[model samples]
Target: MLKDFSAQSLFMGLLTAFVGFASSFAVVLQGLRGVGATELEAASGVMALSVAMGVCAILLSLWTRQPVSIAWSTPGAALLVTAGMPQGGFAYAVGAFAVCAVLIVIAGLFKPLGRAVAAIPAPLANAMLAGVILGLCFAPFTAIASDPLLGLPIFVAWAIVAAFKRLYAVPAALAAFVLVMVLGVDLSGDPAGGVISALAPPVAFVLPQFSLAATISIALPLFVVTMASQNIPGIAVLKVNGYEPKPGPLFAVTGGFSFLSAFFGGHAVNLAAITAAMCAGADAHPDPARRYWAAVVAGAGYIVFGLLAGAVTAFVSLAPPILIEAVAGLALIGAFSGSAVAAFKAPETREAAAVTFLITASGISIGGISGAFWGLVAGAAMLMLLRLARKEA
Candidate 1:
């Protein structure tokens, strides 16, 4: 069933994969740091995640015979960096992955939770997604505040590229890179340059040590965040695109992959929403059936890139900070806008969605978990209680 690949489809697939992977590299580094990993160990973790996500994406797409792009959990990675890393070291972190993995597996195996998730109205789900994206988008503006002169040119370049959406569907990050180089922003301070010096053959695998306190404090919350924030929305994206593959199998595959990758110092692996949307969107192929191969291509690319983790890190290091910030901001703009539109569309749900967005944006923490996770819980609880009261009345 393989047809000659279209240049446009290939470009779209690669573009989506690259931006998705690059945007979350910092969080991956944070995951490594949390686990008491050396620089090389951390790089190795990134490599493993890249390889796992890519491979899984390819296999799933090929098997299902649909265009499916697998991506690292951007939100999950953010949670790890913001909460998991600082709370405890690698052993506890691995415990967190293990717990999350187990929960994902259970959810997949159990019919009820899957059905419950499926039963949630599309608008509400979209609203939740919108809230998540809005919080993510704020990072770029904050970066601009940190360095105006350095961030300005990149931001301008991104806006220009984004404005001309059809000429190039490529993410704004690529344009920002071009502008940063032209503007001569200093990048010597970034630690990405030491990648070569840090490179070495993979070390012996570290086994996870379990502790009740660590699991309760770190692992449980991580598991909740990864599932609620990442996995739930991931399935929603697939459904929204009209690809109704069995959620259980997808969850199992991702969880299994995460369990395996944990030994290599990787945090967790899950379905990607925005990046996966790249393959699912009209851009990948006119015939949705053939788009699966694009994911196959992306998967192969991930394997190759993961093998060269040290080299990639070194290259990333050489890039200017402004370039990274600009690219990340630009890449996420569409997702941010789309999510915002989704969040506020229904008057009835507007307040709850707003609450979710604000709490997530506030970046507050309780019990060592992130605000995003709590925000959802709080919003959902508020909605549920209101519903109950309405029914009683």
Candidate 2:
């Protein structure tokens, strides 16, 4: 097992995991809060997701002997922010999350269901996701207006790094945000070193409360985004890297972990796309066979990070809420760009996609359902109408 271990792979693996976590964890925290999680619940949720992904990645890599990276559903987290909480609040959201997890597991176990999920029009999915994140993407500008000193530097750092190393921009901004938070603000009254506690906070359980509105608005859309935005691309990444493990089993494992995590306030965990390439590519190890070590090492690193989730969450709570939101927004700029490009890539669906983006960004809610669900419904309806008109033409 240790034969393929090398310093280079270890470094790369650790780097990939850290970058993945640091870059978007704020979004996860925000998403949890949006769904009405208390500070402790949000912290526990992040910790649960980190541990779930870490454990899943390690077990999958060992079992498959492949560089299988796992990540939280970043897009799904964005969805939560937009969806807000149901009248039933966090418990209802947890129920929806559980439903999504079950759907994913069913998709993995059933070939047709998996194909059906794959068949969701790519443009529509991208458009819906694009719309969901549009508001948060504007946070940096808003932050600057609200608090120039704390926010401007974070935005500047993100912009500068994005201009050079796009992948690391958010992490760079996070570092700057933390620095500003320390130097500019006063943490003197806060707990000195209690951030790193004797143990991570215990996971809080929420009993599932099912509702049609929550299921339709949150569960279904969450499943679609998780599958379309994360899992599909993750499979493609592994395939591009010349490893073709059966995707069905992968979905099953991630879904199972996601299901377990829901009770503890975590969102979906799935195969990773962006970070997968880092571990699966030749850069991890010249010999592809040895590259699995990169994923293994990354998994170990994530576990270590997960152990500090309470500390991270506590620190986040200490920051100005807008500052945290601004940082989260900056973290997702890449996803926003990617989704926008994908949403508009097809000329035929461009109008429909645009409609979706606009409606979702408008944040309209009907019958307690969020704009995201309506955006998908509206866009899909428009696409069909356009197709029918073309047929008649």
Candidate 3:
């Protein structure tokens, strides 16, 4: 495989890593903050997750000889932002993360549990994911309406790149967004100079403090979303592209890394849905066997990016909050589109999926549980009702 390395595979790998990391890191940061982390802790969370996922991706791809991409759970992070800080604060959230990791590992190790998780209705899961990202997907247009100068150019760049390269659309838009942020905006006026320092250190260990509230609210919901929304679809992406690995083992590896990362303030790590396609598809390499190298290279790229976590954190901090959100929103456009398509694809499940999407997007919380869990509940309820009605009729 090493001898067969080609420029196409290398470029594909680089593109995969760039798109995976650049697009959603902002949401990760926002999640840490929402869970009551300080700037340093949040940066640590980013670095830890990046390293954990990078290492897992490399190991898994090498073992399976497939483009088994790993990633920090972006949907889980979005859930965190919606869930807000648990009553037990960041420590409690960390505990919940650890719990999620354990549950994932259990699901991976126990065949029945893993099968049960995999059994979640695809339409409902996709609807839930669509609901999770809906708010962020609105960022670009919202930002443009609010700040035309800063946002319009980013949108233009996205549209132009999408029209041409297609695959590079979001990344190209991101590059343009960063450029505009640098040139069009004045950073000197801020109290802290917006210079990004490359001297990012390692993650700081945090003691986990578990609470029933957090366990139910954050842990269970996070695990469900990670498995149903991220992992299942991630596996499907590889299967659709003709690269099937044993899902249980892959889940175990990612879950083990997630468990380890929790001590260092990172959330769950799991199979990547979006970037997995980049590595698995024909675009990665003409020879399917050699495509694993693309994932290996992407893993290495993620480690390098993780090392510069401090710089990225500092740089994002310097930008306006809205702009940061806009970039994150732009990054999720493809995901949003995919989930929307999947959610409404089935005529039978359309109404149930709609219920899930509306409830999740509504962001309503009950008894400390997040809307994501409730969205699933609502969707499941509707699906069951529909089935019962159909049987009676």
Candidate 4:
């Protein structure tokens, strides 16, 4: 295992972390803010999540000798976007994060719980995910209307890069955003302070406050999204690449880390799907046995990026909010497309899936509960009714 460390693994690991963090972090920030986190708190969440996932990835890959990658749940964050701020504000959101983490842990330790999560109708789950992200997916186009000069270049950069290499597209947009901030957006005070702050790392911990509303509105939906979209797919990706680690322990490990980070405002962290492919695939290393090194390196990279979360947050703040949203939206388009296709792919479940998508996308909240939770509830009801009718016929 020690001999498996190679230059290729190192390079691939660095690239994977860069892509993973750069791609969806803006969405994470947006979601955290949506749930009523202050900018400082949001930065803290990013930092905590990055470090936790990094440590989880490193520990898992090293322990199992597999290229196991971990990441914050982008779709789970999107679900938070639909969860309007609860009465307890960020603290309540943090409590929900803790609850979601505990659920994930339970799902790992208890097979039945895990199976229940897995039993969610694929179409409905995908549809709910699609609905959650629908608004963010519109950011790029809306950004064009709001700030054409800054937004157009970011979108154009992403499009052009995606044409050549899809993996690098979001990072390219992020780079363009940074460029716009430096060259285009005017700033006050010593911008150097922000840069310097990145060197010291950040700490903005909050005491959690639990409530029924946040548990129903945020925790349950977050757990479902993280499990259905990220954790399950991540395991499948590993199996596809011929790595057969037990899923239960992996989920448990990720859940433990997520739990630890929740106090600091992080949402769920789980197995990575896209970046997992990179770490587990031939690109990480031609020799499959030693490829775990790639994940280790990626984990280290994540920690390094984590230290700069405050700086990244500050940098993003310099731009108009619309522009930040554009970057996040660009990051999620792929996820949205994939979910939408999966939702409508099967003829039997298409109607139910459609119902889920529409309601979720509508952004309606009742009794302080997000439409995402309602979307799932409604879709399941429709499916049950439709099945009963067919049986009668």
Candidate 5:
């Protein structure tokens, strides 16, 4: 294993870790907070997710001898924002997280279940995802509306860098956010005295409490989003890069990690799509066999980042919450755009996709069920009706 190490691979692995952590962390933080987490709890959740996914990535990469990158399910976190405060507060939400994680594990073990998840119409699935993230995606603009001096610079930084390299745009926005935090925000009323003192990793053990409402509203939708948006796409990315690890074991392993992390305030973990590409690509190493080292390095990097999450959370919390959400929104823009395009691509399913998108984005609730769940139902029904009508005609 030591013989496989290379300087290029080392650099690429660390880069993968940096990009993965910096790009979408705000979304995770906000997602946790949205479901009624205290600041300390949210920070703890971030650390738990980071550490869990990091360990999972390292173990999988070493076992398979492939660049098997693991990641938190960012889309599931976005779904949390829409789900709002779960009934019975964060404990029930934690229970929902556990339930979703179990479902993921079962999906891996049961071929029929996995196939059923995979069988969802791509257009409707994509639309549901797009709708879920649509509100967050507007944060950059709305943040600017609230405070142009702080927000414009961040947007400008992201746009300028994105013009050159689309991959680095969100990080650039994050850097700009740091700059804005320094210049614009005032953090004098010290609670922990300063950010440095808050450097230790957060630790909060939440007792899980299941509820029928959370099961219907949070668990099922979260399971679907994690599968459709993150896990499947991650596997596809790996295969495209010439690695073909069995999907079942990987899914089950990640779900197990996700389940464990849930007790510590985390949401869910999955295989990485973006970071996987980074680790598996030619940039990691010219030799395909050597690229797994990048994932190992990335895993190690995530652990280190996890250790510092408390400080990052404490520091960022000083700024207006909207600013953090704005950054999160920026992080998800690519996903939103991709889903939107895919949703409307097929003329036959366009109406069904529209129904899903509209319903999900509406944030409606009925009988303790969320709009995301209802959107899927309504869209499937619309598609069925259309099919029947065509047949009759």
Candidate 6:
């Protein structure tokens, strides 16, 4: 009776899950390629992340008795693309994941860090989060600029669909897909263009190399960025949606999952914010209790896609550049807008929030950590200093 399926709820959940999957997939694919993963290996990594997130969602939802949907570490993936994979490559990247996982597990076990993280003012946290996401949304746009002919058509097609059909849901992505096909973006270059490639089974083993230098340089920053950018926001999204699970188990599970996936070429697996929203929102499931199944469905989809990594990679490659940009931009619009509003909501902290937003959007880096991490620290310090000054007065 509890698992009794409703067509409407199931459909909504699936649509939400698919959008998340697509957006994440786009970023993961790029990150993998940047680090020189073969198409197969990259797809496998994506699949691993999907499986990890999906399983976590189902288990967490069932355990908490809430409508929880686990999602791949979106901010983590984005960071891998911007910082981890680019700077250090896959091995170093995994090292970063290990560091992040260890930190998360420790925080969950210790409780203080989790509590401290939770204690951060809602407006400040929200503002910091908005800044982080705003930075991320620019990637696809940059990707489009790098390949304009391919990007422009996709953008035009997205505009047409948005104007004519009010394609608010998955149809927007679908429209972009159709536009790519119509424009004929040269699929002949794809390695497995016509083949129905068999899915590769998940490999059970990965040998992790722990390097002190890499850990400090790559792993530590990765952990900081993942927590600051991904995990915190993810929890916030959950809280906003009225599903508040204990932070300890959630952090432990996500950390453990990231560690496992890291061995198999997965970058960093953690809680999802935007994708989880899809499952948690009114559009996905009104009942809320049934939403866990959406995560299960997404996980299943990830496994399917992972196995057919070769074919999937080929398909994604065949998609025009514009299509990718348009779809990603549209998918992120809601998240960006929501974060923007939250960022500037508090006048007392508005300057700090603005600093976070500008720094993150600047995409600057010093040593290894991203601008977002530094931005938050700077903002938080500014906020704290202002508070202390007022206390003395």
Q: Which candidate number maximizes TM-score?
A: 1
Please write out the lDDT profile of model 4 over residues 244-361, one tens digit for every residue. Answer: 7677888988999999999988998999866776677665677899999989999999998888877655554556767766776776676677678888999888899999889989
Query: For candidate 6, lDDT tens digit of each residue in 212-330?
Result: 76676556766776766667666766665556657777878888887787777776766765566555544445676665665556555655556655566556655544455455555
Model 4 accuracy (lDDT, Cα): 0.81
Cα lDDT over the full model 6: 0.62
Candidate 2 has which clashing residue pairs, if any?
A: none
Cα distance off (Å), candidate 2, residue 363: 18
- The lDDT values for all models are 0.65, 0.78, 0.79, 0.81, 0.80, 0.62
- Tens digits of per-residue lDDT for model 3, 185-294: 87654322432345756467888999999998899989988886678767756664566567788888888999998888899899986677667766677788888988
Please give each candidate's TM-score: 0.78, 0.64, 0.72, 0.65, 0.65, 0.73
> After superposing candidate 3, which stretches have Cα over 4 Å from the reference?
1-42, 61-69, 73-100, 189-200, 203-247, 271-298, 321-339, 365-373
Count of backbone collisions in candidate 2:
0
For model 2, the superposed segments whose C-alpha errors exceed 4 Å read 112-199, 314-393
Model 2, 169-228: lDDT tens per residue? 666776888799889877754431333333555567778889999999899989988876
- Clash pairs, candidate 6, are 96-219, 151-322, 199-307
Worst 10 residues of 5 by lDDT: 188-197
Please report the TM-score between candidate 1 and the true structure: 0.78
Worst 10 residues of 2 by lDDT: 189-198
Score candidate 2 by lDDT. Answer: 0.78
lDDT for model 5 comes to: 0.80
Worst 10 residues of 3 by lDDT: 189-198
Model 5 C-alpha lDDT per residue in residues 111-169, reported as the tens digit of each score = 76556544557777777777766877888999999999998998998899878977567
